[model samples]
Target chain A: MSTPFIITKASGESETFSLEKLRHSLLKSGASPETTEDIIEELERDFYSGMRSRTLYKKAFSLLRRRYKAQAARYQLKKAIMELGPSGYPFENFVGEIFKAQGYTVEVGVILQGHCVRHEVDVVAENETERILVECKYRNTPGFKCDVKIPLYVHSRFQDIEKEWRKLPGNHHKKIQGWVATNARFSGDAIQYGECVGLQLLGWDYPQSRSLRKWIDEDRLYPLTALTTLSKSEKQRLLEKDYILASELVSSPHCLEILNLTARRKHQIQNEVRQLCGNGD
Target chain B: MSTPFIITKASGESETFSLEKLRHSLLKSGASPETTEDIIEELERDFYSGMRSRTLYKKAFSLLRRRYKAQAARYQLKKAIMELGPSGYPFENFVGEIFKAQGYTVEVGVILQGHCVRHEVDVVAENETERILVECKYRNTPGFKCDVKIPLYVHSRFQDIEKEWRKLPGNHHKKIQGWVATNARFSGDAIQYGECVGLQLLGWDYPQSRSLRKWIDEDRLYPLTALTTLSKSEKQRLLEKDYILASELVSSPHCLEILNLTARRKHQIQNEVRQLCGNGD
Candidate 1:
């Protein structure tokens, strides 16, 4: 008679286990033929006598996901963006904010019209004497070549904007200036065209020097450098009003400079606080 | 006694074999003691009999050669370059060559001067009265941000160049009659700058539209067209003259285009060669 199955024990012992043997080992000592068949089928699929088969199953599972799902993929992307921080925001808007923060009176996302085309300019910054237009671009890939179409298009669009500016009331619009900021690189021909027409091709690096990186490095307006100088008590009141944020600002380089500039005054203030508190600590 | 090495050669059988057992098994075969030691060493290292060790040796040899030798590495790099073809070359140079091959008069490396920067244009192409400049950038990774320094520096450099060009002699000497190109991408500020200066920022798609891809695929030459234009007898004399590198002229796009343009009526000469048994096949 043939044995239906066999078992190799850990102690290096081997035994033939027939259906009769299985029934004998079971607690109830009785099983229906159908139940026996089902159990055997499951055992064949799930239980292997060797370790290698178990490893293979685990390896296969690791190589594949549970199933394809779009929602899960999007969640991962959103999580990644949120973690990358402020510089990761929409490229043009980020630069525009940087320019505004840099003490330039600015208008961002302005529309410009040209002779044959119309487009939007990203920023227009002005002072009492001069005006400048700024455009920002965010490019992800390499190999964008700027050539004829770009200059012709921008010139046409700028023309329309220039016409509208000419109609602006009084000298308020007289100093309006134009600029383009691109994250992508430009070709030589495009640069020459811009030169011929008096336009600027501020590729990726120029604006970083002028704006965004400047702000992150802590160039901000504060009390000492305020447009209007303040009295001692008024400055104290202002500091108290924003104490938590003011303290948090200490980590910035610009704030450190500000603190250094006011060292003598800060010492006096600290003495007063100490006198009131006594040796309480 | 010490534990003995064991191998179960038969089912339901358990046995232990020591060096003494091994000696007895081999003694009747008349192998020497040194031969037995060699056999034992091999068995120890490769206990799992079915596995082949040659693959490990081969991999080790390859690693040694690749790390220690320059020629092997260069050979691998060359093969990879050939495999990647046009895409493998710097995008700026590759795209410029494509335009040159297309019968356009092309200057591969050009320097453009702008009011605020100097830009190295990748290719300057002129056809009749039309002229354009191009820049190409190759990116291996996605989500690339343009560094602001280079473009701004270039802009500043361009300004100096332009200042010189504005002078009388330089004005005529340094006129770029066209656009700029970038393979990677431009930022919003760059686009605005382009507008301000009348430079065109042509995207990658624009150049690809001019059949640069198709020309590369078909290996078509302008010289073939020129050659077809030459009269039969004149074409024969020209081919016999050996004034040009026939192989390079046949293969190079620039040379081929020139030949096609110059050989406007030379197709009949090919028929004569065919009739004169020139076909070795």
Candidate 2:
């Protein structure tokens, strides 16, 4: 019967806070029904008009971390991804790994000759019948949406590259597609222009059923930064060394050697990584 | 003769510094041949391999300022244009004024409905036979160039607007054009793409015969910031009140009244403005 509390989003827009959305997200993070209800009750006491969504998220994350480490890590997947940057290279590699898991041969950064000029493409993925060029737009700040200008510029780049590609001996019969993948949402105009031009846009929660979040979760390809046991600097070190995915550490255990953690600490992190990745020891 | 004294450009490229180029620019700024020779000689003594061109420019500007006031202001036209912003609104207005000088009805910062969405266009100019949309890209930094992405994006926006414009009555007969104007230079790829797509590109010194600088000098449309008689804060105050052009003051002397200057001080600025604009008293 009362007016719903208004919350400020990262994009500086205000919206009425929905209890159902919060409850659904908590359950999605593997929180128990009782724990989810308890957290909801606790959060209700702190709810006020004009509260920032970021503050609300932090409060929930800290509360969850006290009860369950792995669940808390899972709950903060979006934030953890943002922590991978200040630079965009690591996010590009993370996107490449996602495509790699889908059985595509991926190159993270490569320079390709366009008809007019040379372009440094973010990710190039290839399969038997198709080649995909992806421009990964990474934003460390939450609520920064990729605008229409991004896809508009990207479409032109694709056109140039596609023209050069068709001239190669074996490329005429292959399908060449352009994709724009971002760690943020797409503006309505951006999505409209992208769809109109046939440039596949994959954002954080766009295309609802098969977004970046869904792909990461479905493939069990969590970023190394998702490990709660590792410190922020440790995650940055691994990212700098081109170790982006936690699943990467499973294959190349030697990557941990660079961190120089004690044997006990290393085992703890490895155990957390394995469990979070759904790989049973 | 000694490896041509490589000087670094603002865009981070190194090129052989040409004495002829320096002489040409100084002469273009209305410097006497004797003064130009003296300044060039002073600069040569300080020239070294790997020295920044910015340092070379400062040396010449300082030497010129000592000898001539108005000519030095003309010499630093490019820098004065850059001082117009940290924001791009004033630059947009300046660009609008350029089109207005050509007898086109110009609007700055107008929102137009596109085929799918709305766009906040920087400048819109309409003449009897032509309607042009200009995107003013202003960079406060010395060496930043408008790249291909800019024109590519502007082309898409223009396409959307042009489509909508065609649906309106009496628009089909007019030639619709998109322009990317910048106070700096354009990258080679940007020029190539813009030319390929029929988008007009106007940069600081592009097209050689009719660049932004040439247009300003030809029309005597120097920005108020170019007046050395006014202090930086006074120039900023004028810009804040939309007094972008020095000619604006000649038409409406009351704009200077806003600065609360002494009668003598006001006369000093008015005299300088008239001299720069060739409105000889």
Candidate 3:
């Protein structure tokens, strides 16, 4: 066993670095135990007593990069996601897909007429049971909670449309409800306000298994932005073609005919899609 | 019922297009039943008596794009996977991770000394029971089966190494075994040859519950390429840093600090990682 070393965390507080944790993370990444041990041994050999964890992490990562590029790639998924922007059309489509899965006829960027004004609804979903005017809020970065003010604004906006649209039996909606949805979670106050006002809220984990993430995974409706293999312009082209989810490849894989991809590349992706979402759950 | 349309099959045969299938697929993609009906109706209204299924698919996709870009994106997932090359290092890393979970100490792209010469091994794994040399074969395109020649070559290679290394007193590996793995399925003769020669084989679906995909899903060790949100370079950078699995992001999301991402973006990825792999099964 190596002596304990103090590591300055990103939080500015210092904590003792555990070689065991590093080894565990490495093993979790699929590195052979020998490779994991070798990397740890090397890291310990050069490690100083009072290094910042950031530097330690970087060194270990750098060492892993040099020894096994493939293993390193498997461990850095969260960082890879930062490359995909969630506050965009892709996420809105992702959210819309979930609502659709729950049996809602959903549309993004819909326009609904209010009593006193015209409101641009993020999503408007309709079904035999009820019609829901949804606010499709997308966030690129994580940790942003949909706050109370948003619910307050959307609540008023729904009322504005409800006040005017409710007058007519068959305008855009006969009788509709209101929902505020996000790929991120809602704040405590926002949830309170939404529940208090009888407004429905949906998010990644807002309602547990009934949340947005659950629906997407349940149907394997992963967004195009979630795929790590696409280039920016390639993703743009797919998006331009309205191909949002990786499962979309399920039906329209021929869409790749337009892109300059090798047959083997196409086959690999198709196989991956089949592997990921080819079969029905 | 709408009039049936003609669709040209790839086999050079024509078939009648089922509107119901289209409706089911669209609805499965999270399109509301009404929107699905409306789109089907419009496509039907513009229906030429003998339009190709391809033409009809294009028309429906175009309309869906115009009306619901989000929904369109959801339908385009297959094409997206081509953007990801599944027959490569990341995938090999993915495979290695699964084996690691199965209690193997693994190494990718290893070299072993043979009776006559030295051979490069795709993966070298060991535990208390067996020391196995593996050949990781990945194919980007579908329909390319691993033929008998693959296992033959791998068996020969393993036997060569075994002849020399078996006499060693605890080199990196003691007495060794041979296994050939591919992401694609094996040919009939290939499986026959592997079984006859006593060589182990693994693929996406080769051995049922012990298949590579089954193992990945059982552990929730999904490839980051499955995420639609990451860009090419971002995935590369993360891969370079050894971050390839979505689950890895759950523990050390601050790894994104090197990338120029917003706070919200980081948070979204963290949330997604948690959603994908947070609750351990």
Best by TM-score: 2
Please give, for residues A1-281, the per-residue lDDT of candidate 2 as tens digits.
04578899999999988878877888898888888887777777787778899888788766565458666666788998998899999999999999998899999899998887788899999999999999999999988999989998898789889989899999988999999999999999999988877999999998898999988877778899888889999999999899999877767889999988899998888877777887331
Instruction: Write the candidate numbers in order of decreasing TM-score.
Output: 2, 3, 1
Q: What's model 3's lDDT at A60? A: 75
How do the residues A131-236 of candidate 3 rate in per-residue lDDT, one tens digit apiece?
8888877776768778655765677567767877767766554557888877678987677757766788987677885776666666766665455456677767
Where is model 3 more than 4 Å wrong at Cα?
A1-87, A170-175, A278-281, B1-281
Kindly report which residue stretches of model 1 are placed more than 4 angstroms away from their true locations once superposed.
Answer: A1-84, A88-164, A167-173, A178-281, B1-89, B102-106, B112-116, B125-132, B137-176, B180-211, B214-281
The local distance difference test score of model 1 is 0.42
**Each model's backbone clash number:** 95, 0, 45
DockQ, candidate 2, comes to 0.30
When summed lDDT is taken over every stretch of 10 residues in candidate 3 chain B, the lowest stretch is B72-81
DockQ of each: 0.01, 0.30, 0.00
What does candidate 3's lDDT look like per residue over B78-106, in tens digits? 22223336447765676677678778998
lDDT tens digits by residue: candidate 2, B79-149:
88988998999999999998998999999999998886688899999999999999999999999989888
TM-score for chain A, candidates 1 onward in order: 0.40, 0.76, 0.67
Misplaced by over 4 Å in model 2 are A1-67, A169-172, A257-266, A279-281, B1-67, B260-263, B279-281
Q: Rank the candidates by DockQ, best first.
A: 2, 1, 3
Interface RMSD of 3: 31.5
